[model samples]
Target: MSALLGCGIVLLAGCGSMPVTGDVKAVDASQPGDSQVQVYAVAPREGAAPSEVVDGFLESMTSDDPDFRTTRKYLTEEAARTWKPSEGTTVLAKAPNRNGPSLHDKERRSTETSYRLTGEKVAAVDEESSYQPLAPTDYSQTLHLVRGNGADGKGEWRIDIVPDGLVLGQSDFKRLYRSVNKYYFASGRTNGQSALVADPVYVRNRTDPVTRMDTATQTVRTLLAGPTNWLRPVVDSRFPTGTALRKGVTSLAPDDQNVLKVPLNQKADKAGQGACRMMAAQVLFTLRDLTSARVEQVELESDRGRLCSLGADEAEEFASDNGSGAPDSQYFIDDKGRVLRIPGNTRGSGDPEPVTGPLGTGTVVMSAVGVARDEQHAAAVSANHQNLYVASMVADGELAGPAVTSRAKKAEDRLSRPSWDGRGDLWVADRDPDSRRLLRLANGEGKPQEVTVPSLDGGRIEEVRMSADGVRIALLLSKDGLMTLKIGRIERHGPESAPKVSVEDLRQAAPQLTDVTALSWSGRSRLVVVGKEDGGVQQVRYVQADGSTSSSGVLPGVNQVQAVAAADDELLPLMAETVDDGIVKLSPGDNWQTVLKGGMSLVYPG
Candidate 1:
């Protein structure tokens, strides 16, 4: 017998109680345990009772069984044949509790036995492997079992009807799956140049039960499948519709020279050389950080012949603005209200210098500043926080009149710190109580336009930050003395000459944080959030755009953080403004160190 089966039998033997009579007791197989421990499923013993069968199956779902064949053993022939485990996954707060073996027919003694499976649903992973966090709610499902004859010529109990997909505890789900990013081209290109956007999804950490593919292969299949529903409106997949991996290919690995060769189906052969190259680029980006061995190149092929290939260097054409082409300089407002910059590649407490612009020259005192991704222009909020000014950083020049101004009676309700998107547009929130709105300025010079947020739901916009891809925006909203962080999709409709922009489908990005003080986009699908949980101290942590938490998300504690900033290039140090430390930076594997003795509103180019 295999070691898996051996381990399973040992576990089953330890159950201690036998079910002989018609009285079937509920079995709770999901107990909290070490997440790193591997679990294996045991097949039903001959003449096993219904409770044993159900318990075995539920435990099997949490195991790393390659094809889930052991789990199927607990089901009837019809149920086994029809069950689709790949439909989706439901993650609960803990192992689902088995409620009762209630009689399916109370009037008479029936062969059918039923049990209620209940738990607190915390999240769901759809068929596309996109995870969405759900407000905690009660979850209930039913399992029907029938007595039948086993292949061993003995009476046995098997599941006749079962819930679709897999139900797993949060810890088990985390142990079995990991998040991976699939690359797609942004729908709207700037200056006629395309940039790749990341669409993150979960994949099995080991071999998948449904497809029997390794993690890398499963990720590739998901990429070719297409983007998730939330991101589909703003991104385009390079793979042709119906395109898929060559049938029967289950595993993929880089060659000795770190070249990954992907064989697609016949549909991919229709792509022209340029389109084929783009497809290869998508693959290269998706797999670049997936494997231990660096994938230096990607070659696409069909049964007919080689379609196209892309190398790590050649794929730079599709690189996003956040890519590692150049380091981003960090900026902050000094105690004197002048904008100062730290060189991008500087190490440990580099000297801060004033930028070559009016705001930096003290010509116009500022309280906050946002540098454009190109580092050529900056938007600054007046020291009084009522007016926003945009000026060139490449050369000293007279500052233009306020590009945007607020009329609120109080300084705190006037204007928010400005932010620049990858497309050179500026975004800021007008917190005026009488006229709360999110405003955007085209090219940072045009008149500010109020962007509609249909889902604001009476909440006031406190601050605004734009993603580098221009398809998403992060907002800090205040309502009823509570603050929340939300991520909204930026949808551009109508014609390019006069487009209608609306921030829609706002989802909670940091549901754990009761009061979010500040946040910044840290990577393609991650953010550095500074906030406090209910009745907890202030914390700085990393959170995925999808709102899922990781074991390593929490960072070293920083006191009284007023604002936080991170670069798309994660290697750069993280900067924060604090009440006691002034401007401080935390480099990789190091503690927070003071960068400036007295500074505020620290930021990196968006």
Candidate 2:
């Protein structure tokens, strides 16, 4: 790292006299005021005095010695004279410096000190402490710039010296260097500390300590971006650190809201209009918790680097020519873009899906499933890229509930399964998208109620799914937060001895629960609930999908995590999402971590 530090660096000059105004404030012996005034200006380049001004200023900042020292003398005819303190000025760099003049990293670059000048009115001029570096890159020193007896007397402006970070980001860095170059040549580009005040009058004399900043910029740029950097970087290295600097996070909602996701087809087909062309992955419209609609043509192949539309709107007419022999697995979202209701997949814009369902960054995983489009729950069984999967709700690899959508005509025997029970269970309801609707399956010899959700856009019924307990069913409705045959329902409350095994019973049991926000069943007996408290952060809790939590520690860490959702025992064991270059794992053990640097780790959930 020492090799990164340059040797020709000069120290502060022009201390005994004022660098600017040509007249350093004398300790006025016959004064009416209480203090003195001191002013420092920009230094000049090498060779000539004006050129050394900037160097002098820098030297003052870097030097252990005072860049300028003047005595406050008092003597009036030897009879009685007075000298008092007034205003004192100081400068500082606001933020901590991540990089300094030298570092081991080859990519590191050096930056000049930025100064924040301020003043204070005092009774007397006092010596100030030496300046200190805020971090590795910044330095700050405060001094009472003046001491005077005037009506206006107090610390004045608070200024900051802009550091390399802001300076480098500016687009005109190169041009500024050129203007300073001309000033340097006339000064003979000497190698000594001096001053150069830009204040108009001092323009003629190169001897004056202060001058223009244009000279320093040119010299520095030449040394840094020039051939000299090849042999030994003329620029100083940045500060050293245990880790690299980082940027803040941006909301995922904003990312999806602005970016439109569409599916593209390469091969031409004669099946339908715009059949093989990359049609707009139409944004499905939904009334939040109500109905949904759109005209998107998406498929499970979305997981294969494509974004599949779950809405009936987009895929309504997306029929592939049967003569071409399209596979049974290939299907599209209706003309609408919708998905299983996942907790955060609220399509406030009427297109209900994950705030992140576009699918092209390749950051999503097989675990990167699109959530169902519901306010209470989020669900997606497959992706464009994930391998085929079987759900506890989906037995025998067959979707026994809602029939899959197709572009071709339907057959007479569309196929059917017994409702909840072996007999004809019949309590099926596909009304609301955000609520629960039960489909009754008889225990014995009875006909089960059929499940038929209406087309959200007044178009057609698309898809549906049932809860594992076989009590609740989910339907894909239109974008409106309402529905006709609303599936949203409260589980019936039963007696305490024979408690009703439904959500309503459990919710009714809570004396203070008010309402439930996050609801999920842990197997059959336990249920998890997460909701915000009136006065505190959100509460992470659970009871029975059908039972109330009366026990202590129901919600251990309130607000410990944001965006909590139900992750069954099955989804927690492996890596769930890959973001950037890191993997976010959802451990069933109730823990998570990310990979970065040599690896990465997320904030721990205590």
Report the number of the highest-TM-score candidate.
Answer: 1
Which digits, one per residue and each the tens of the lDDT, describe model 1 over residues 14-84? 12132335553333343333334556666777666666677677878887766778888889999998988
Model 2 residue 543 CA deviation (Å) reads 0.8
Q: What TM-score would every model get versus the actual structure?
A: 0.93, 0.21
TM value for model 1: 0.93
Clashing pairs in 1: none
Per-residue lDDT of model 2, residues 177-277, tens digit only: 11111100001112221111000000111111111212222222222222111112111111111211111211111122332232222221211323212
lDDT of 1 at 189: 67
